[model samples]
Target: MDVLLVEDDKWLGQAIEIGLTERDFQITWVRSGAAAIGELQRQEYQLLILDLGLPDIDGQRVLQSVRRKQLALPVMILTARDETDQVVQALDSGADDYVTKPFDLNELAARLRALYRRRGGHASAEIQVGSLRLNVNSHEVWVADDPVRLSRREFDLLQLLVSQQRRVFSREQLERQLHHDETPLESNALEVHIHNLRKKLKHKDWIETIRGIGYRFSCD
Candidate 1:
């Protein structure tokens, strides 16, 4: 999943980024609330991890802005404060989940997965579309009954497409979902991933290129 991590502490931010990346999460780390808001406006993210303490503006303000814009993005508050009032305030401000500092990386990852699943209107971790089955939590994919090994980017791309089947996704939209600001991508990187996905799934027509438009997951 693409995550926007808004954290100011350099060491903590680095640790969280490294840990989440190891767990197959695409993280874009920003130290200020302004940067976080800017990133949100510029790209699409599945989740947001916001720290209450920021250098420029309070994290609550950022959360308020997100709600005002009516972005249905799942947000998780990650902060050192664990006061009851603080927790209540954040939830009231539209945070889907809250995690205090000194948290377990495993637990954080699991919570993130839960939030993502709920946001996608999925009641479980597994998403089955036609003959393709994807276990979101396990990051595993299968065609019919046979297992299919996919790279991290490939899996993310497939999940996005299949979860919202039949929706035409522009090249820019898919590219943003698969990449973040820090990572430099080749010009044909998106095409390469799509090609690899079609070949691995053994169904060239599953992902249809809409000429000058883009691509979509087509079961028909």
Candidate 2:
């Protein structure tokens, strides 16, 4: 998953970037509120970490602007302020969660996972489809009683499809969610991943190709 981190503190920003990267999350760090807003507008991110004490524009304004535009991006406020009013205001302004600094990186990671799962409409960390079970936290997949190994992209693709089973996802939507980079993916990149996933599952019928419409995790 990709995250937009808005923090003016260089040390904290670097620490967060390093920590999240270690956990398979792509982080884009911006030091100012304006820069953060620009990045948010130009790119797609799974979550946003906004600090209320920005050097340029106030982080509250940035959050308000995002809500005003109805971006629907999950935001978690990471700041030094622990005031009750501040927390309430942020929440009312559409922030999904709040974490006051100085905070534990592990807890932050867990919170991010929860936010992502919630956004994906998953009620739990584990998703079960037929005999296949996927543990979102451990990045583990099991088919029946045997474990299955999947590449990072392949796992992400499967998770997306299974989380919203039977919903047709366009190639563009899959590409954007899986690949955070702005560069265009190769024409066969998605196809290759899908083929590999099917081969790994050993169940071709698990994922159904929708002819011209892309792919679906067929629950039928």
**Per-residue alpha-carbon lDDT of candidate 2 for residues 1-220, written as tens digits (9 for 90 to 100):** 9999999999999999999999889999999999988898898788999999999999999999988774668899999999999999989989999999999999999999998888767668888888999999888999886999998888999999998888999988888767966767787899999999999998999889888878999645
Could you say which candidate leads in lDDT?
A: 1
lDDT of 1: 0.93
The models' CA-based lDDT, in order, is 0.93, 0.90
Report how far off residue 124 is in candidate 1 (Å): 3.9
Stretches of candidate 2 exceeding 4 Å from the true structure: 124-220
TM-score of each model, paired residue for residue: 0.56, 0.56
Q: How high a TM-score does candidate 1 get?
A: 0.56
Which stretch of 10 consecutive residues in model 1 shows the poorest summed lDDT? 176-185
Error of 1 at 88 (Å): 0.3
Cα TM-score of candidate 2: 0.56
